[model samples]
Target chain A: MNTPFSPERAAELGDAERRGSAAQLAATSGLPDTSSEAWRYSPVSDLNLDELRVVTGAPPAPPDAPQYVTEAIDSLQAAATVSVIDGFVVAVELADGWVAKGLSVESAAVKLAEPEEGPNLFDHLHAAFAPDGLVIKVPAEVEITDPIVIRSHLSEGAAGFTALKVHASAGSRVTVFEYQSSESGGLVVPMTQFHVEQAAKVNHVVIQDLATDSWQVGRVTSRVEEHATLSSAMIAFGGKYARIRTDSDLAGRGATGELVGAYFCDGDQIIDYRTFQQHIAPDTLSDLLFKGTVDDESGSVYTGMIHIHPDGAGSNAFQTNRNIKLGDEAWAWSVPNLEIENNEVRCSHASTVSPVDPDQRFYLHSRGVPPAVADRLIVAGFFEEALRRVSIPAAAQIARTLIAEKLDVRLEQP
Target chain B: MSELIVDQLAVKVGGSQILSGVSLTVPGGEVHAVMGPNGAGKSTLSNAIMGRSGYEVTGGTITMDGQDMLALDTFERAQAGLFYVMQAPTEVPGVSMFDMLTASLSAQGTASTDLAATLSAEAAAIGFDVALLERSLNVDLSGGEKKRSETIQMSVLAPKVAIIDELDSGLDVDGLRTVAQRVEKLTNDGLGVLVITHFPRLLHELNADRVHVLAQGKIVTSGGPELAIELEQTGYGAYVEEETPEPKSGGLDDLFSM
Candidate 1:
């Protein structure tokens, strides 16, 4: 079958036999058209797959962590840290009795988990082109006090593919924070998965600050078992057209999950999100909130779905999406949905797309605050609600700093 | 110190005259009260002097310290030491009192040192919760809390003239005393006071130097603080009888025709 990719491009992707077969399969299936519901409002046609030259094979030598990655680790109190470049795990440091796997040269490669429903065109493309990645698998009953910091700082390769999976054992507690950046986040498809065993707890935070002219199409999927809990937060500040699709399953009784996101876009960027919360067991609960701001002719889209089956009786589910448009041309689309087939359940959803409250602006002015400064404060304050819901302590502060930097470029002028 | 002078102020809101030839002076280091019954154009005078939108000054002159105040924006007017504590201050969610006060002072290049300490001291003086100073600005606060909170803000700015509307409406006896005492301290330090209220209890606490009766879109009379006591005894019956009927309202038909 003729494909957008060259056969040699597959070899450039990886020497792994698994990758070669996956690439061949993707060569036949090709990318998804906009007909698919998931591809709606997405810039799928703009993806020039053959243009990205990803470094997928083994490195020439043991690579060293870049200054940015090393400095970020030093500034953070990390129980373990892993740095990856162009899909290769280059550095790993474990401290204070925390054990993880797939961080060494012999065992760096991890088998990608295919979605049960089937792999989409992007998933197959990711499997075909991805290289050896750092997979942090935690042992049972071990409680980690600090975050397992994962830095995917890929700038050399024009684009790359990375897949990270977290498998938390029963009765264990762990926190993971992932930071992704590139000259742009590049035209990469990064995938993440989480499996929370019975009675375990997991907290995850993801921050994306790609440069202009970048495209990041990513997926994060998780399953929570009996009595376990999973909480996740995502913060986005850059990317020309970035999209993340997340799916969480409450598969066991008494399981719980919470999802939060804080995103800011400026200068022709479009940050999109589509999420699903599946309640499959009785007495399960799931809550989700995503808030963002669009400025300087930029736009954002948030579409969420919640499903409660017959077994999901006596469950609770909630979803809320709020956005502030700071520029005259800025825009947002917020859609929240719910599908229930059960009788005893509590579910609600709310969404808003508004400019800053004029009364709030006037109140600040009444206090002698300048109009420009009052605007900056209100925009910064809009993120406090979503940021406080993040379990990771450092996520809020880091997001605040990045937001302030973005505000400075638009505000600080004569 | 100089006085805030409103001369022959005739203002219209939405093409209806609310204040007609109303004039008063709030000199620094003295308290002046504007008392009247409801719909007597008291708040309109305050809103117009502060240059709020929708309050059009059809014919008037408002000057402060010999500077033409109408040429300045509302925030610029505020930056130049004009402070007004409104009747019901609106809530701004997610913006902390610290953020507002810090930016308020810093925007003016004023000394914002020890802002939290200053807020705590001022809030405690008005019997307000100090912890609320760290929370969002007036969000979820009770009516009395908002009044006291505005008083604290008044103390923080220490403006030359403070135009307070309904200062005693939302306060209990104790709350009113403490809030009045805080403002009294600032007034003693040469801060001019323009307290607008229908009740005379706050005027007694404030100890006004001048009292003006505003009715029929104008000030009908002016006297010493003793005038407030006299109005309290006699009520606004005589002044309200001089109703300059609104031309737009054809009295009986305007109320029941619709």
Candidate 2:
């Protein structure tokens, strides 16, 4: 373990109690390189762990700075604006109608000694490393028109953790937009926990366009209540190594979850994604579609699964992963798994990993588009489906523009 | 002067020759029909002319208005006044027909593609519902609707040469009449029409100037409309292989060689 760290550096763990707790958390969280199912495709040990540092100071303020403005960010229906700097909640603006209670977002030193839920090791990690995060609570029967916007900024050499807890009461509806960016170069680890009450609805949007030299790790878990709906989107277009895992549980009858994602990776960028749609109640519906494109020597991995419990009869689920590699040097791997413990359920998964069709490109080129332009056109067309699902027009166009840049082409509007 | 000339052209797919030394010329203002049974390479001929990437050009030359068509890519060929209404047009999801058509036109460097203005006029001319153009390009469109959308595309692009591939498929009598009317209008506007089909019903309605019967990848017979009538009545028996085994004889050998 000391191979990469000197004796003095290893002593940074401080007291025996803190070292014991860190070791215990690392061990029991099943994050080991050997036995964790989730880590099978990705090896964290290969990340040069010792080289990663916790936040020492504020990240460099970007020129023309932060990816989103307060106005555009707050435009999401009924959503307020919350900005996090170096793992601390710097600014928070709640909506006018919603009254918040019993939820406090302060420095981790002011919170409990340990995470209330042991399974959420990142919560404890956030409590330890993060200066602050946020806690949002919605009481019963309240409906919000705007989506809350949360922007997390990371600068070079800045390693920070933030934990977001969103609890929606029965019949409450809310939408949250999470934007993550890295200024200069750095790494960020973010974990989010969502609790949806009976008949509630939650729509979440995650936008990641980090600096080229940054790395991002994000995990999201949701619990769906009876007759509730959770629609989530993860759009990743930049960063060197961006890994996202979204796990959802439909634990009550008539629950539905729709997950859509679109990513564009180029150069030596590596994008890893893992998702799970668990059915624990009858008549639940979960659909996931993620489309991506890889150019140059970029690599992408998508491993997804839909698990149905025995009591979860009459459930219907669908998962599709489609990607187009613009160059022979680019690579993509997709694996879709279906685990069924019930007899009367309907679930299907399909994945297509192929380069752009020569015929399709020729067809476009025959119309006078150059070969490179034709490739970009078809690739954009390939991603239009997943991108179209996004509600904001500017965000959609920005996503497509980023994709064009990733493919080394300009977005030529007709 | 925008003419298409195919001189002794040969095309192949997957190592099998489909069009062999086929020579035909389509002036800027005429309707030509290529009638044949299944496997006659009628569709293959149109696909080859469009420079569809999968096919190989084995021999001969294709020229459009004195420019070498074979030297151009599919899009370039399309830009040079050639439009192939695919037999099965790809259903591109999330791309609206208006956007796709206008983008295609702009890509080809067309100057008259104000989508909203053009769409309204074309929709009125074709009696197409204006709302339909806003939907995803060909996605969820019915067979007849897809054909109509292709026709709408033709109307918008207004290319010099328009190749219709089996426009009769999935169309009822009324739809066929509508398509024929549009094709007649296009032809009257001086656009060259190359209609590839097995059935001559649409050709007869549109009054083809020349009828070529394609057999085994080449035009075996070229004549007036009478040839289509003849084949429609005779059922391609002369070109098709005999179903029943004939005893070995010179008569059978002559019949075998078409």
Candidate 3:
């Protein structure tokens, strides 16, 4: 946990990678400005980057995961699996001649996603101090329906930045499941980009079950081409402060994008989500649904924007976010916005912040269910809708199990 | 055999006196019917027994079998063998009918290994839509369907005593007959029943051994089932005058109640 981001580690990078990191570091002075609309109401301003030792040395050996994690992976039976500890790719296993590669500094620098908007502080830091990661590239005209799984984990008292890229060629189909777990006092920043070519189908589900004391700030930028579809879901249950910004840019005509974010927080943990559904072409469609629950003193924030460009005529976009607060002191904030520059487009947004319904609780109790079990049943049932929306069946099953496990803990204390 | 006895029950709800001096008895294996007009404390009696919030039992002893029910919570009373068929059953979203039955049966410690098949058969018997077994419990269900769901629950759980409050409100002739048959079937198995209804239509199908007139929070008169037939013609105008005007809930006054 020493100064792994020191000048000695900086000297390890090649000339081009070093120059790219230097440019990013010089352009961004500090953390992303919280006053900006993109960072409004976020907790990143409270993050102490100096307190974290950004890893740039040889990554440590991956630790033995807890039984639950291994059980989840065993249930998946994924076609290909990759493990990245800290920032280094430690293991990769493929079946049926799958396609994947260990990412290098050169490839990581090239795959880095820098939008028209300037890169923020964490984004800059990721570019400056990232190590070897993983890349999944599906060949054209091929169909790999089985998921290509990736496990990214970080050790205690250190920060990890894993750069990952996924490219689905034309007429190809694939699925990716990325699961992240970290130790206490860990800071994890993962940058991912997906290029879904024309007429392709790509699905990605990310389950963030980090330790309750860890912090994570990540981003996913995906682009869908003509006649293609991109479906993404994120299930977050742990972390002191976790935030993920997801942007699905429909850049081709007749492209479609579906996104879902489901999370539950307890005991002062904060979960934040920011999403952008960018309809850049005509005849595009995008739908987003985010549902979450906050208990104890925890809170959450969900702010989504649907932008339909002028050329996006005949586009249809919808955004809905709902959150339930279980504790008297818990809070949730939902803000949805629509920016339409086309006359023929249709767009709608909805959000709500409510508590566990008393009438629902009473009905369950009157049926012989205990008060604590009644609450657990209501909350478990509440997430069924969001979990069913997960495009991957296996991921949905694991998410459901994780949710039940958490509820079981509640049952024990109750 | 089970018995439900209520002695001099007094109740208040949301700063309004809903029931006072209400007393009734339902012995094992018998069906007793209570007929009353709107806001005459029929629903209040059932609500107070079920321990609904906002309904305070100022004074009463609700005993089931032999234990004091007032000392137990709603679920404890339910697990102790009591069920109430509400007039307006609550719609619990995200909880499917199957899940509700599973949790209830499990909590009751009587979950048969083949619950799916038993529930399917019981739903068919109670005239509940079998296809609705997959949907959220009572959510978006029609009034009759909600009533059928409640009846299905009663049939599945097979509690020792059941208090039916206006179960015939939204049922058609066929639905009413099927529900009555289910209730009668349970009653024959030593289940005591206390049914409250506004119309004689349900009694025509249900076999009630005794009938009582509950007006103004008190049971004014009790007689054989013939009283239900006679009251169908004469109404509560006869016994209502002899009883004091307790004014439990005036017609317009109930509308403003919480």
Candidate 4:
């Protein structure tokens, strides 16, 4: 058993009902090990559960707003901004127009009462520790023109857990930008669930820029109904061990899902990603592209699988993952898998791990670009393909700036 | 003298001699054409001068404005006022043509903003489309467009010495004429040029000051503009002899022994 949950501690946290269910589940199942397929190529064995303490009670007041958060809000012109500090929702602002249009934010208990698909130790741990969560819901057929921004910051030595559920009604449209950032050592587990109804369109982007000593394990699970479209882009550039697992389900015919991610890590950091694209209905389509770069002693791991069930005949899927290793010590592992149960389906997967192209470097050098500057340009251009697919101008710009800053540091290195 | 000089240059590629004891010179303000047969090592010389890897210069003294170029890296050579138009320009997916041109110009201490205006004006003057400037470097461009884009890059950098290898290979009639006009314009503006081509039309259009015929890794002939016309009419067959008959499978020793 993990750790016995004290009922008195749950009462002190003021969420005994939710914590009870999480305790029951945690008592039954333990953390995943390297032998588990989902945890392969990850640093799961290195995680120390004893060092983590459950954060409870009222969330401390947030510190002064950081520059990046302010800049992202201004650039995106967000309709509603929600701030979470130390595992609790500190503040939320819903624009007057959005409020009139039936957009609402509410505090709720963790809803993972029973084990559903893709349940893990982190989910139960979050439910047991997190006191409250923020839910953003859009009404049927309504469209929110401006994005909703959720910004999270974890203080030093604080192990924070937070949950977010986004529900878009049939024929509705919404875009959300989640920015996770910190400057000190900590642990943060954030789980986000999306329910995209029939004919609805949703765009979600997660940008992670944490401190070098921080660790994050994030999970994003979404279900798409008939004719609905789901697009997600993950841009990560921080953390000692930052990982995101995305599970996208196309449950109805004609549903479409697109996933793209770009990440860069330096120092001794590690960025890991595992994604599942499940096509359960006929004629559904899914496409994924992930590109990343690692410099110094940093490394990255990407493993994704596209599964087309028997009912998924006439479906189409494509997955591509490309990585660049900048230094001799830098490493990358990319594995793309495809599973098809029907003959009429069309699926393709490609992966590559290499250093920067020498021919490209020579081409730039012949044109008077110095070696270091040439590398910076090539790395920036490497991410441009996915950056252009972001569809959100402000989010794309934010990603571009972060990547450029990282390259700048690389150039300044001895 | 401020001239691009190649003195007794010998180059090897992968342990095979490609350019042997080749010597030539193109002084400032003159256009020189190196006309040769298909295997005449014209491209090898350009690669050797630009310090492309795998093209080893065993013996050579390549100098521009009295500065030794063989010792410099490719980018350093460019900084020393040497530019090359490659036969097959690489496609860089994310870097735009404008970005490359600006970066090159900035290396020469010119502000990118100021150079952008000049580049736009030059593009207009040369009849090149300005929309291509926004595209990734050499990506998804037509053959002729890639050549013209290289020319545009040349106009932006304004290097003192430029080596253009087979600039007319992928060009149409109009493209050839436009490129010839640009070459003449740049030459008249006092930029020395060395043109390597199989056809004489571009050299004739540029009013080349000299023409050198390279055969078997060496320059066997040099002349004025009339040589280009002569080579165009006679082809390279007259200068190159057929391979000598095989050794007769050691017939002389067999006959003597018998």
Candidate 5:
């Protein structure tokens, strides 16, 4: 199979070998099929990667910058922006403070070392081109209020890879907002790894808005230290095939983790998400809630697990996934699992998959709210729990609008 | 000026007729007590009046304030001053009482009034914590607490007509007195009150203007408070005594009547 070279991997090699190596990685990595757990809901075999080439289209001209990002990024004066053009990181915007601390940003193709078992898929992503990869490390006690923005723009016929690594020191508060936007015919693969030291806090908000013909596969992992707090929120809309896999570990005593995901699917779109909240130490806590609604033949899948190890005594954890079936054909599959070996731990998991209640519809319709408006109200109420918990105000507002638009329903501002 | 008039109402549930030829009326600013033994179509009549989704009203006209109450949905009926405090309130897991009240109030198209402050003052008068106002709506609530919470909702929403079913069944003496006082306030404010109860204690406190005895889905008798005292003494035997001739097959039927 013939494939294109990744821009990131080419940076580590002479121009000639970089394309060869990237082509090899792309050729060896097949499109995901039904056999993989992550690809269960979205069948990618039909994507036909063999014929797709690396996108070479120019990035879309920046629109009026979003006010939310402008304010949130400005607050993090010490952070930098790693901008991606057609899945390739074309430029890195670094806060002068970070460049002074020996921070470096470049594209490199990392290879997976041979292990006892076969190489993991994520390592393959690392081994391929990382044209938009950024390596970040902060000193101890360097608190930053502003957020670092990693913005990705996918132009026409663009396909690329982007990866990020954020390492935070003890007692530091760092916020990162990753924006994935595309209006092109291509695929964007993004994988991020976060490291939080003891007594540190890291907040992440991932916003995905790709073109209707685009595909996005995002994977994020957070390794949390003792007494560390990690809050993550993923907001996604408008992708032909979008799936996000998030894994976090509360490895230290008194560590806390918060995971929230809100998505809207419309126009035969498919969005699937999987999250893992692991409690590995005593006195640790984790909360997970992923809520979404599907309309217009759209579908969503949410599978979450909270694993409490035997050593995780006094661990308190909960996982909830709820979805509203808007379209007669729209579907959602939610599987919540709890594995607990400790006797003193408290854990519960619940999942509900049902159409809007007839009674609730009648209740709203009786109030002069038209049937369509009534349905929107119920769907909005369905996701209100997650929307209220979205830490970013602008993100929350956009989520509300996206939900309304996906349903093709309009709401008078309350 | 306001009245809930049900004319010859017939209702069916699960393919069985539970209420037939049932006709009753509750006028404005009055407390009407409907007393019947279990399975006598008491709750079915109330549910039919409020236009519950499943109950099939085979034949009836329910008019409130000379308007077609039967045409309204449950919440619309409520918005038009009709309230149904269920014998067993539905459990809303994530909805808080405070939020439900505000939403309901807004749905009723009420504007610019402080329901929370009014409810707080009422709760203080009833010796309940203002904090109880923060609890989830009927979630993790005790039977008595659920009843009290419904009572608070009625007080705060201030519907035009309140239909309270078995409000005293599960309450302690103190809780019962508190609800009775709330009902009195509603009636004082000119809202029609229809309280359904099998016992005389609730009516004794309510001082219902009309006492209707329902037997076999019909109002067999209607009178003042004395009617309750007479039914209590005669054990519904007087009505049967004058009606039943030859008591050979009067086993379950007689027990049900009593």
Candidate 6:
């Protein structure tokens, strides 16, 4: 058995209350068994929880800037930049006029409390080991034109856990762009929470390009209140096994949420995504679209659910997931389900797994395009449908570059 | 000797014969029309010449400028300056017509600045709406619009040898006249053209140099442009046999001969 929870570790990390709660969770709920429905088709069984140790104190000096971070810094003229090294907040910089306008960023410890609903093993583990949390608050009536960027770089053989909380008051609007990269093999777990108040709007984008030997498990949960809008996009391109779970709760009437994602996995990589669209109030709307392509021996999994309660009458929800298989050994699994107890709601879900259309290829070939070039153009067009919906120009460009790199590798093969 | 030639060609699809020992030629600076009843292997001949898949050439020779085209892939033949305007253009989602035209022109070594100017000029000359360029290729387009877009593509490609298959089927009177005038102009400019049609109006307008009548997978007759007018007046029944009986043998002799 593992050593008992230490009071010293608690004092160095957070309060004793958080430590007790995390200890109780760790003792009661162990890692999920492979027989569980949610864990099926996932590589969680191969993970060893005991191998990861709690990290404390200051992290090593910040390493050289990663390629993705440099590219993002060059492309986005951000209003502020936050650098996180090994889950430690190293620096936070805001533009000149930002402090006077009621925008603040601070370091705080997150309370190790279980979610009211849908508590998982990873959430408990993250609560037990999180180093420090970052809190970003935007006051009422403050609108920021430039995006705030967050960059995370994980070093070799390190296990890091981090939490971030974003609060947008009524009538406020902000955009956040997060870029995560790694130098070598490691495990990174992160959790994010968003509270969008009444009539507020938020745009969030996450771009992950980790090393091939690394593993990432992340969670993004948001609550959109009355008349608020939330637009989120996720572009995932790297990692050995990268998985993210998103939960969007429309808590009040007239709220809207949109989720879009584009991912390309090659070689032996695996990208898994799970999304939950919860409509609890009347007259709310949620739409989701995810498109990805897998080549070589890679695989992808997408499972989404649209839940509409009885009070969620007059709500509209849509979910779509499409995947293209470029190699004979590549595989994709998509499962979209709807749970509706309401009588007067509109809900639809569609999922497709297919190879490239022969007619499209023939059409291109008849126009003098080579086979490899034709596939490249088709794949680019496939991702463009979702990328065009992204609001940030720099984020979209970065995603396009990653996708082109994957296509180039495939083209070079005999 | 620089011409598109098909000599005693035979083709099959899915283990069934389609074209049997058909011969035709279209020299430079001339127009030739192939008139036939439905299912006489007219489209098959065009498709075979373009090297489209599934049109297996059992015994044939297709050459342009004395280079064997049957040994090349579709894109290779296209790179060799062969073009074909299909009967039913395919609609590709998420790909714009302007992008396709640019890619085609760039494949032939056209510069970017020249591509835009040339495309605009060609579209205007063909009476095609410039707005169609922004829309997805052939998606949500009417039959007449699709034919017009094909004409624009042909003009942009400027191929050395062009095969126009059933260009008059979905066209209106004005569209037919426009296409005929375009083909006439191309032929006048020394581009070899093979025009396949069922109606005689396009041939009359084109002032075709030769007309070939195809029946039962073979050319039954060949003559000047008047042949099209004569066949239009009387149907193809005169050239096709009414009936032919199956041969029979005596049972004892057939068995003993073996």
- For candidate 3, what is the DockQ? 0.59
lDDT of 5 by residue, B1-258 (tens): 588888888889888988887777888789998886656678888878878777898887888888898887666677787887878776543345665665566655663377778778877766666787775455577778778877777777777778889887567778888888878878988888888876666787887999887777678888998887776655554343344432322234543432
Candidate 6 lDDT by residue in tens digits, A141-227: 799777888887777756677788888899899999888888777778878888999999999988888887778888888999999
* Worst ten in a row by lDDT for model 4 chain A: A2-11
Q: What is the docking quality class of candidate 4?
A: medium
lDDT on C-alpha atoms for all candidate structures: 0.81, 0.73, 0.81, 0.83, 0.71, 0.80
The deviation in Å at residue A413 for candidate 5 is: 17
User: Candidate 2 — which residues are off by over 4 angstroms?
Assistant: A1-20, A23-36, A56-71, A100-127, A362-369, A391-397, A407-414, B241-258
Q: Ranking by lDDT, best first?
A: 4, 3, 1, 6, 2, 5
Model 5: TM-score for chain B = 0.88
Model 3 C-alpha lDDT per residue in residues B1-258, reported as the tens digit of each score: 788999999999888887888888899789998887666788888888888888899987999878999999899888998988988888776788788878888887777788778778988887777999888888889888998989888887788999998877777778888888888889999889889886655677888888878887888888888888886665666656554543432233422331
Q: Candidate 6: where is the Cα deviation over 4 Å?
A: A1-12, A20-30, A48-54, A58-75, A111-118, B35-40, B97-113, B129-135, B140-145, B168-184, B197-208, B212-223, B230-258
lDDT of 2 by residue, A70-102 (tens): 445544554567777656676776655554532
C-alpha lDDT of residue B145 in model 6: 76
Best by TM-score: 4
Alpha carbon lDDT of residue A283, candidate 6? 85
Model 1 vs. true fold: TM: 0.90
Q: What tens-digit string does per-residue lDDT give for candidate 4 at A29-145?
A: 676777877777777667666665556665576676557657767887788988888678888988998999999877776574333455677776676777688898999999998
Candidates in order, TM-scores: namely 0.90, 0.88, 0.89, 0.93, 0.79, 0.88
Q: How many backbone collisions does model 4 have?
A: 0
Model 3 alpha-carbon drift over 4 Å, by segment: A1-8, A16-28, A97-110, B127-135, B140-144, B213-223, B230-258
lDDT of 6 by residue, B1-258 (tens): 259889989999878898898899989878788877667788888888888788999997998998899988887787777788878887876677677766666766763776667767767776778888777778888777788888777777777788888786567778778877777787777878888876566687778889997777788899998898887666566765556211122123322332
**DockQ comparisons of all candidates to the true complex:** 0.59, 0.41, 0.59, 0.62, 0.16, 0.39
Chain A TM-score relative to the true structure, per candidate: 0.91, 0.85, 0.92, 0.94, 0.85, 0.93
